[model samples]
Target: MVTAARLGPEERARAWQDLGARELDVLVVGGGVTGAGVALDAATRGLRVAMVEQRDLASGTSSRSSKLFHGGLRYLEQMNFVLVREALKERELMLTRLAPHLVKPVKFLYPLKHRIWERPYVTAGLTLYDRMGGARSVPGHRQLTRTMARRIVPALKKDALTGALLYYDAQADDARHTMMVARTAASYGAAVLTSAKVEELLRAGERVVGARVTDVETGESHEVSARVVINCTGVWTDDVQEMAGGRGRFRVRASKGVHIVVPRDRINAEAGMILRTEKSVLFVIPWGTHWIIGTTDTDWDLDKAHPAASREDIDYILDHVNEVLSTPLTHDDIEGVYAGLRPLLAGESEASSQLSREHAVARPQPGLISIAGGKYTTYRVMAADAVDAAKEDLGPGVVDSVTENVPLVGAEGYQALANQVERLAREHGVPAWRVQHLLDRYGSLLTEVLHVAEGDSSLLQPVPGAEEYLRAELVYAVSHEGALHLDDLLARRTRISIESPDRGIVAARDTAELVAPVLGWDADRISDEVAAYEARVAAERESQSEGDDLTANAERLAAPDIRARAVGRALD
Candidate 1:
């Protein structure tokens, strides 16, 4: 078994020192899936690599995705077969080979509104989708009459549709998946550090040499030297290009997508559902004991760090999904809400939905390669292309990408552990469901995680107010995962922010104190972290109550960023 690299405080400090001490082959900026993918690809190819992120891993757009790894069905209609086929191949890889423990098959029911023509049209699209997937890990489409559909989803309105079609896709915790990717890269001897922001570009004569990075936690700066710097900052691609003082080849436009989480019992559906909106498609995803109904796609020009969901966005989702629901939901039904930005390649179309999801890689300068505009499912392909673009600066004898054959950390013995869930649950004195949950999250690393709570059984108990997670997980988040602040623990590490009805406010203090010893937080530090988290939740709540984007953004900006506070600076 390839043991995962520890990303705790000590490892982070060592990584920072190593980053500044040597001249690396490739320096990756960004800790999202694509950046992590590039680090993994470059490292496994026998190149010295280091990656740095300004915030927690997957803290931005990567964490807030629809959490699906499917070949885009809409792309088939748009005749973007190359993207669809590539994404499908990647999805198959994740399901069967690379990350089988994290990615799982999920079924979605497409309700047909047009009686005579819809079925055949959808059938044609789904047929090509099934064929493009190559090695099939999920079942193909199945047609069902209105009555049959109602039997599967009793929550549907009587007149919602005449028939329905079911197709298979895959889902995962995007944040956890991205974090695992970063850890896997670290395990492959790549230096990975979070809370390290790129302050300036280091230039040697005409060619870019490296970056001046600032440690956000301690306000200390270090210069990291490398032959080539790969920019994979997604929505912040333009910002990085500007920082490099290069002539950017392309522009990235931000598109905001919002999702609301509701209790599962509110919608009595065994299978997830997909509905066609006027602008884009909406997904009613089954997320644990909740149903995640989303997404309104619109152009966003405001804050990139925090995208706030306006009242109109939430109502738009509710109005569209409620069109077919037997029991129409009110605002009170929403347990949590989140918004994220998509970095689309700027095109002629005025609408964000019309922009291409296809990625682009360009060597705008001698030693700087910038990659932008890609879906999460195709991140590996994007990463490989970025590294390939940097080959000129990387010099000779560089090897090809080997990540397709390399399984992520914890994927090796996941199935073996999965087969022994009952035994593990009994030994741990937890329920079978708890073992299953841990298996899905940590896979074979569940043992390593459980090892954190060895001396005290109380740590094994569920987190106060957030019963879905154990107290041990919070401790593990700080002691194992590189969670630096309370916000990281509540938002990215455990997803308590968007999963809890109170937006994790009730559990913030308890969780902060839970990891205080590991994080070396004093009483004032714990108080500050808890207060910041609470203010963030309050700002989000107020933002959701606003009528438009501008008002929502203003409300969201009221909360001070904890990371910014650590650096003794304010967000621009």
Candidate 2:
């Protein structure tokens, strides 16, 4: 059996040592889906690979997406068949083969305001969407009358829709999926390290060779050499290009997208809804116990690391979503809000919504490759194309990408384990629902998580403040998953940060205490972590209240990064 690639503190130290001791075939910078995907692709192709991220995996745009894997029905209307077909094929692959444990089918209802011509138009596009990639994993489009549509979605206003068309797409927890990709790469012998920032690019004369990486935790620096350096920094693509001492062949524009989460009861819907906005489409996705809405597309020039959602952005979404809801949502109904920046390829269009979702790869100079602008669904393709671009420096022995055949860490035996959910629950002395939840999130790897609870049934109990999670899961996050801080566990490893109404403030102290022993956090460090998490939540709340981007950005920046604070104390 292949050993599960556990990324605890010990493994991270080994990775940093490996990076400094040996020359690598590929060094992938940026730990988002694309960068993680690149590391997996290069590793599976029999190349020595290492990946570095300044923050946790999927901490940026990867975690804050609308979380859909679709053919972009709007693109079909634009007559972009190639992009739609490619995305749909990738979607099918994910649902059926690649990560069935993480990605699953989701249905969306498109409410039509017009009586006659609208239904046919949407139906045609959906029909094309259904057949584009030979989509067979999920059911095709279905037309519904106003009564039938209302039966499915009770929240819709009586006259809000003349009729409706329902279509199938897939959704996944983006951060979890990205972390699994990184873990899978590590399992395949790739040195994956987080909180390791690349301060500068290493060059041998005109050819880029490697990078100088800094360990954010200890403030230690190391020079790591690689034959090929692939840059997958999404919004910071141009900045990395500048670090290479040359003008990039293409420019990357930052587009801000914001999503608000509300309790599931706030919107009485059996199926998710898709509404047409003047600039772009809006999705009311059905998340577990909550409904995710909004995603305003606007230009963002301030902070790429932590994009702030203004009050205007919130109002824009609420007003549009209220157009069809019988019971309208108010500001008080909102549980959480998050903002992310999409690295869109620059074009002539003034509106960010008009920019292309297609990705571009450039060999800006020898041994340097940069990829940008693709959406979440097509990250694997983008990664493969990036490696293809780096083939010149990788030499002739490098094999073609086999990531399509590679399942992520927990995907294997998932179906069998899912079938025995009841038996598993009985063994663990927990509810079947809890077992099912663990199965969905960790798949066959649930055994490893449950192992942390051995000799103590208390670990099986639900976590305080966030009862949806098990206490064992928190310990496993530090002992197995690469979680170094409270924010890493709350935000990306699990999703308590964005899911909780208090924005994980209520869970901070308890969660910090839970992982303190494993992460070697003393009393002072635990207090500091809890304090920092509280300040972050407060800053986010303050930012959300601001009316404009400038004020919001200023407010959000008030919270200092934990790593920066550590560096500061070291300097003192």
Candidate 3:
């Protein structure tokens, strides 16, 4: 198993220095799901690999997804059978074999608008969706009348539909899943680093060779040599290409998708729900303690890091979902809101909404291979294909990717541990539900976290406000997972940031204190970290209030990454 101790600031820097000073087979740009997957895919193939990201793993579109391991149902309407089949194959792989601990089946209720025709029409699409791509992972779809559907979703409006169709898919903690993919890559000897930004590309006679990477945290830069560099930067794919001093055969268009989170009780439902919008589709995905409802798809032309979701976007979601809810959720009921950009392969589209989800890979230059425009479900396949194309540049000695059967760090014997959840809880002196939650999040690796909590029973106490789980998770975030900042733990590591109405304000101080000992932070460090986190939350709240994206983006930038400013002061 890959220990959580690897890929710290020191270790990651050394890896980059060695690569810059020496040579490697492949260098992956972007630390989202695809880049992480490519790193693993290449490393397992007996090839030297390194992946670098400007921010944390899954920090971009990967973390902000709808969190489903689903076949693209909308793609069927587009007659994109191949894409749907391809994604469903990956979905089955994740649930049954690849990352069973991380991915599991989830059912959704599709409300039928028309009295008769829509039921069979939607049923046929879902039926075909269940059949394709070695789909042994999830159960088949079920048809339901309006009355029966209301029982499952009691809060759904009476007049909204004639009937509904219940169908299965899978959900995951996208940030955690993406991190595990990177950790699995590390276990296979891939040099994985975060907060490491590529300042420019290294070249050898017009061929892209490696990169000059800057350690954004430490204000240090190093050169890394490689035979082939793959661009997996998603929306930032074009940025990476520009850094390499040139163009590609294709361009990526940014499409912004926004999601809103509300407490589960806000809309009482036994299962998730799917609804149709005038221009696109919406989903209320079942997340623990809360439900995830979103997504507005439209052209995005501003800052990529923080894609602002305007008041209109929020209203658009609430308006559509309220159309079907008996007790509609208002703006005050929302717990959190997030926005992510889709890296669409730009082409002949009258509007960005009409763009395709299909990905494209190309060796635009002799030594650089770029892949862009695929869904989160098919990231692995995209990674494998990215590596396959890179083989042409690297030549012989590239072995076949062995990542398909490889389980992530937490996946080994997850089913057995799940079965023993009650016994484990008894042994650990915790509730069975608590054990189940840990096991779901960490699989067999839950023991590692529990062991720490056992050392100090204080760690057993839950966070101050968002008491859904234990304090040990915060410690585990720093000790086991690579959570450097307070935001990383609360926001991505455990999701206390989004789950609580205070946006983790009540929990941030406690979480920071828990991780401080492990990180060797003294009084000043803890204060700085805590203050930065509060500032971040404040900025986010301000951003959400703005009337539109432009004002929202401006508000968010108010809390710039002060780490850079800190480094500058130290240097001066």
List the candidates' TM-scores in order.
0.98, 0.99, 0.97
> Sort by TM-score, best first: what order?
2, 1, 3
Worst 10 contiguous positions by lDDT, candidate 1: 563-572
lDDT score of model 3? Answer: 0.85
Error of 3 at 421 (Å): 0.9
Residues 1-572, candidate 1: write the lDDT tens digits. Answer: 56799999999988888888999999999999999999999999889999999998999999999999989888898899999999999999999889998999999999999999999999899989999983398998898999999999999998999999999999999999999999999899999899999998888776889999999988888999999999999899999998877658999999999999999999999999999999889999999989899988999999999999999999999999999999998999999999999999998488899899999999888889999998999999999999999999998898898889888888999999999999999999999999899999998899988898899999899998899999999888887888999989988889888888999999999998889998888898899899999999999999999999999999999997899899663221
| Backbone collisions counted per model | 0, 0, 2
- Which lDDT tens digits does candidate 3 get at residues 44-103? 898888899888888889999999988878889888999999888888888878888899
Model 1 regions lying over 4 Å from their true place: 569-572
lDDT by residue (tens digit), candidate 2, 1-572:
35669999999988988888999999999999999999999999989999999988998999999989888988887787998998998998888788899998999999999987988888888888888863589888898999999999999999999989888899999999999999999899999999999999999998999999999888888999999999999999999999999878899999999999999999999999999999889999999999999789999999889899999999999999999999999999998999999999998488898888999999999989999998999999999999999999988877888988888888899999989999999988999999988888888999999999999888999888889999999999988889889999999888898788888888889899989989888898899999998888989999999999999999999998876776664455
RMSD of 2: 1.0
lDDT of each: 0.92, 0.91, 0.85
**Candidate 1 lDDT:** 0.92
lDDT of 2 at 360: 98
